[model samples]
Target chain A: MLSNLLVQLINGIALGSTYALIALGYTMVYGIILLINFAHGEIFMAGAFVGLMLVTVFKVHIIFAFLGAMLFCMIMGVIIEKIAYKPLRRSTRLAALISAIGVSIFLSNLANLVFGAKPTTFPPTEEILFKIQTYELIAGAQITNLQILTIVTSAVLMVCLQYFIKKSRIGKAMRATSQDYDTAALMGVNVNRIISYTFAIGSSLAAAGGVLVGIYFGVVKYNMGFMVGLKAFTAAVLGGIGSIPGAMFGGLLLGIGEMLAVALGLSSYRDAIAFGILILVLLIKPTGLFGTQIQKKV
Target chain B: MLVVENVDVNYGAIRALVDVSLEVHEGEIVALIGANGAGKSTTLRSISGLVKPNKGRILFEGSELQKCPPHKVVEMGISQVPEGRRVFPLMTVLENLEMGAFTRKDRANIKDDIDKVFAKFPRLEERKKQPAGTLSGGEQQMLAIGRALMSKPKIMLMDEPSMGLAPMLVQEIFNIVKEINQSGTTILLVEQNARMALAVANRGYVLETGQVVISGAAADLAKNEAVQKAYLGV
Candidate 1:
């Protein structure tokens, strides 16, 4: 029983890292533009499908497949922003949000038309990257190579993102844009470009999450983005919508909570419990666990 | 160095500025003074490319400014210390200063300029790692002015730099403004504090209800009967 719990903990973290990857996109885009890109989940789905095609059809290396998916999703994200959201930027927030939902619907249906509704599976791990092997962690607990890969990928990407936002010029501009759009413009930040960058980074990260999820679960579907998207959005809100570290923390916490729920024999109501936490967070700690704003006393 | 000729600006159905005209010469502190809702900020906004003029033109260094975006305007060496000291509040003081220089192309000189800013306002250096929002109103104002300076702008636009500050802080801000001008930066100052503005400005424009009702040397405007009564609290 103790080993089982440890195994669940590892699985939870692996799953949580994927959610964190996608959650970062939601939080960053929302932080900069105040528009929840509801279409983001579709981007994740597209990334998975793209990765599948790259591996099975193009017969490419797995690393290249992942990179290609991320690149494709980056361009797709920028185009979607330019076409769907940029026009409505000055309009009411609801208008932009509706546009996002419309984009989400349109993309999902397009994927459905192309890929069919049936779930597709990734090539077996040995056929692409490596042979599956498990290493014992504790008395009865064991960790798989794939789980280690997922956690490491997530950790590296998140660390890189944090460092970029703190040290790089464009990343700093992105932070400034999130803080104050007009003030950023006043400081000579091309806010339109920054918005495009936000979408690009968010979408790429989501795409990375998608590819990882596809490999880990060994399956991909046209509508797979729907449930995961909602979960990632929940994670973003749980972490505090505009805070980056909050999204990471929130995703891990949610992942652990969901795994524990499943371990307790509540698999059927997993989504219900996930969303229930979202409701609880909204009702109780609306500012979230890591509110970034430090207000000045005037 | 900057010219606004018969500019008109409207917000929906409301006429914010009607046939407004003003100019600022190189190396001079030009103050645009008026009462609240008198379109002082609108004129500055129009010049800074934040708002487009409905009619007329704005020329800076013989280049038309009606079409440039705010960042493009900054690229041409005009920076505004915007109203209310609108620093990027969550960013560290050093980061805020870096943002001010975002449009400059001389990447290598940015560090030197940052050091220059630190020299001008060493208090900012003391709080370089602190978030701008945590600073006192006076320090924030200094950060704002210091931030604008980081861009190496030829002319600086200052809007209500004394707002929400104590009297002593206001005096200090004005002194800093004067020093900035004396050190070869042209200033177009917008202030409701007519007395302080006139004291620092070489020339002044009195904007009343979207029109420039008076324009002359600062000393003359300060001595004018209507200006003394309406704005200067004589």
Candidate 2:
């Protein structure tokens, strides 16, 4: 029983890492602009497809493919922000939010036209990323190389992001922008550039999460980002929509809770469980766990 | 050196400033004194590139400023200590100071400049690691001024620095304003408290309901019977 619990915890962590990566995108964008950025999941889906193309059509190294996907999503995120969100910045919040929803539908449909609606499989984990090896923990519990890779990569990326925000000049400017937009510009920050950088960084992180999901599941679909995006968004909301560490913690907790449901033979209700928890959290705490003093949309 | 010629600003349907014009030459403290709705802030906002004027132009050191964004305005050696001391509340005091120097490229001199700011307001250094939001109102005001100074601005635009301060703190801010002006940075001040403003300013512009109703040397404006009756509470 103890071993079973250990296995579930490890599996939960690996799954949670991907959710955390995507949640970071949602949280960061919301932090700065107070936009939900619904199209973010489509960016994740696009990242998966880009990774698939880089690895298979171009026959590149998995590492290069991963990096390429992230870069592509970064550019795409910035372009989407420019074309969709920027013009509506002066409009009411509802207008921008509707735009975000519109962008999400447009991107997902475009992906559907290009990549087909059916799910496509990755070539093979062994042929690309690494040899899949399972290590026995104690008894009846196991850990896999893929799990380790997912958790470690996400951890590293998050740490680098934290360090950059804490240390770099642009990062400080980003924080200032998040706190007060007009004031930041008054302080000589090119706010538009900061907004672009924000979209780029958030989208890149979501892209990385998408690639990891593709590798772990060995499948990618045009609409895969739809459900996963909602789940990651739920994680963001659960952790306080605009807080960084809150997203991480919320994702892990959700993943663990889902795995716990599966362990208890309630696998079919996994999605429902995630939403139920969200409802419960919100009922108790209107602001997610790490909601700042007050982040009212201006 | 700056000049504004026949500028008009409107917010949607309501006009904020109409045919407003003013000027500030090198090495002088200029004050704009007005009542609550007299468009004092709109004038400063126009100069800082926060609002666009419908008619006329603003020139800073011979260059047009109407089309420049706020950041570009800062780059042009003009920084504003905005009303209410809108410091980045969540950021540490040191970070707020660093952000003030965001447009500067001389990374090496930033530290020395920060130390200079500390010399002027030593309390900030002791609380450098603490967030600006945690500071008292007066400390936050000092941080805002220090942060603006970090840009090495040739002209500092201050709006109502004494709006919500105690009597003693208000005097202290005014004295600091004089000291900053004496140290060679030109100033364009907006104040509802006309008494203190005229006392501190070299030249003054009296804005009444969005137009320059009176303009002259500070001493002359202070001595005007109408000015004393309306603004100075004589």
Candidate 3:
């Protein structure tokens, strides 16, 4: 039981990384503009499709495929921001939310039409995991290469994002805009430019999450992003919607909690387990762990 | 010096500011006093580049500011403390101050300016690490003013600083506004509190229904029968 728990812990961390990356996209977009960017999941799916096509159809290297996928996803994010978000900005939040839902549905259906409804697999990798140990803390348990790669990739990405948001000039602009868009603009920050940059960064994160999931799970499909995206968003709200670090913390907790629930013999209720946590968190800490409660001036 | 001539602002089809004109000379506190929806806020918004006027030119120090973006206005040394004390609630008081200086490139001057802000608002210094939202209403107002001071603006535009404060806090805020002006920063203040606005201001204008209804020296406007009835409640 102890070894199984430890193994699940490792698995949870690996899964959490992808959630963290995708949640960063969700949180960053929400932070900058207070928009949910519901189509963000479809952006992740599109990125995976881009990677799959690049690797399988063009026979590109995995590295190039990742870059290509990120670039395409970034462009798609910018296009969505310009067309879907910008116009509805001054409108009610409900109007924008509905539009976001419309965009999400449109992209999902669009991807289905373009990529077809078939599940696709990445071409065989020379190495999927590096097995480090066969010695079990309990009988018949081991850590594999795939898990390590997943953990390392996600950790690297999170650290890079931390550096990017904390140290870079554009990162400062994002933080400023997120604090107050009108005030940020008053500081000579271009609101539109910063917003587009935000979308670009977010989409790239989603793209990375897409690729990592593909390698870890050994399957890629147009609909795969839907469930993960929802989970990532759950993690985002769990940590706090407008906070960067909150997303990371929230993702890991949600992933671990989900795994533990499954391990404890509630396997049939995994999805319910995730949503139940969300409801509990919202009821208890509506502003999230790190999120501040904001009050509008009368 | 700044000049606003025949400016008109529209919110959808509703005109918020119609044919509004005003002038601000160097080293003076000019107050705009009016009731709600009298376009006092809109005129300041137009000057600060938050709202682009449909007509007329806003000239700041000889440059036409009719089409300049909001941030560029800050770069040009005009900063506005917006209506209702819209401080970044989640940001630490220090971070809020840093945001004020976001356009400033002179790191040395910025440090000194932060010291200057802390000096002016001692309460903010004690709560510098606290988030702006946690501050009392008076403290938040002080922080808002302190944040704008970090921008090192030649002219500051303030909207309704005393709107929701205790009477004593309002007096304290007005005193700080006077001190800010005396320190050589020109001010364009918008207030519904006419008595206080006129007390600290050298000149004053009264706006009504998106136009300037009255303009005069602060003392005269304060004593004007119409101003007395509408804003001063005299």
Q: State which candidate has the highest DockQ.
A: 2
What local lDDT score does residue A217 receive in model 2, on the 0 to 100 scale?
Answer: 94
Candidate 1 structure quality by residue, lDDT tens digits, B76-161: 88999888788888899999999998988889999999999899888999999999988988899999999999888999999999
Model 3 chain B: weakest 10-residue lDDT segment is B83-92
True lDDT of residue B178, candidate 1: 94
Listing candidates in order, what is each one's chain A TM-score?
0.97, 0.97, 0.93
Any residue pairs clashing in model 3, and if so which? A129-A145, A129-A146, A130-A145
Q: What tens digits encode model 3's per-residue C-alpha lDDT throughout A1-298?
A: 7667677776777788788889999999999889898888888888888888888888888778888999999999999999998999889988888888898889888877887788888665553233343344445455566667777877888898889887666776788788778877866678899999999989998998898788777788878878998999999999999899999998888888787777777878978998899899989999887787566664
Q: Compute DockQ for each candidate against the true complex.
A: 0.63, 0.64, 0.57
- Per-residue lDDT of model 3, residues B1-234, tens digit only: 999999999999999998999999999999998889999888988888888999999999999998998888899999888877778877678877888888888877887888888988888899898988888888888888888888889999999999899999999989989998998999999998889989999999989999899999999998899889888877
Q: Considering the two chains of model 3, state its CAPRI-style docking category.
A: medium
Instruction: Write down the TM-score of every candidate.
Output: 0.98, 0.98, 0.90
Give the clashing residue pairs of candidate 1, or none: none
Model 3 segments beyond 4 Å from truth?
A54-64, A127-141, A166-169, A288-291, B166-169
**Real interface contacts reproduced by model 3, as a fraction:** 0.62
Rate residue A254 of model 3 by lDDT: 85
Top-down lDDT ranking: 2, 1, 3
Off by over 4 Å in 1: A294-298
